[model samples]
Target: MATPTPTTDAPFGLDPSGRPLSDKSKVAAGLLGIFLGGLGIGRFYTGHTKIGVLQLVVSVVTLGLGGLWGFIDGIVRLAGSAPTDAQGRVLR
Candidate 1:
């Protein structure tokens, strides 16, 4: 089997600074979710491949309605109400 490549962003369990995450990254992620949500960029950045793929496929199939949901999720994320990632760490 092929090994998975490391992502450009931080690893699944840590941030660039080796800390869990600060509120800053979470907020930034949320903004990305709002702006580039159609591409699932934020989901990928935040290490949510499943959700990201779903968003990408659904967006493609539904003509960007997935983007609308992602946009709303962005607002929820910015409000510090969205669920944390697999690592159980809140964004930034």
Candidate 2:
């Protein structure tokens, strides 16, 4: 018997560069941002601590209006255009 070789495909769990995908879920992050964006929940879930902290500060300072950034980010993520995670891996 021969061992089947693993294919390096995005849907197969490998990134374009043939690396393992991030453990984070795009939908989960999106939902978190849409609902608790003001709290930077999505950014935190995506492992972007700096962005999460900044988002929190901005949302707090702007009286929550700044949360629009996070909300839009969520939409973008859902649209399949989110950036890489803090560890430079694309979210799975």
Candidate 3:
């Protein structure tokens, strides 16, 4: 018997770079950005403390306009224009 070697052409279900995003923070961030993005809760959940804090401040300062910003940011992230997670890991 021989051990099966992993191949690069597995499928889209995994990351080609082999650094697949298994981090709960990233998933949570993505979800939050998608749903609660208006409040920047996603940013905070993903470890982007600076951005999260800024979002909170902006949302408060702008009387919830920051939520729009957060929503846009979430779109960009989900679209792959911005791939860094809260820990800055490029999602695959």
Computed on alpha carbons, the lDDT of every model, listed in order, comes to: 0.70, 0.79, 0.64
Q: Candidate 3 lDDT, tens digit per residue, 13-59? A: 23445443424444555667867876778777666778888888888
Q: Which is better, 1 or 2, measured by lDDT?
A: 2
* Model 2 residue 72 distance off true place after TM-score fit, in angstroms: 0.4
Model 2 scores a TM of 0.78
- Reference-based TM-score of each model: 0.68, 0.78, 0.65
Best candidate according to lDDT: 2
> Tens digit of lDDT per residue, candidate 1, span 1-92?
45433344534445443444433377777888899887777777778878888888989999878789778767778887534655566575
* Residue 9 Cα positional deviation in candidate 3, in Å, after optimal superposition: 22
Q: Which digits, one per residue and each the tens of the lDDT, describe model 2 over residues 11-71? A: 3366555565677887898888888888889999989999999999999999989999899
Winner by TM-score between candidate 3 and candidate 2: 2
Q: What is the lDDT of candidate 1?
A: 0.70
Candidate 2: segments with Cα more than 4 A from true spot:
1-12
lDDT of 1 at 13: 40
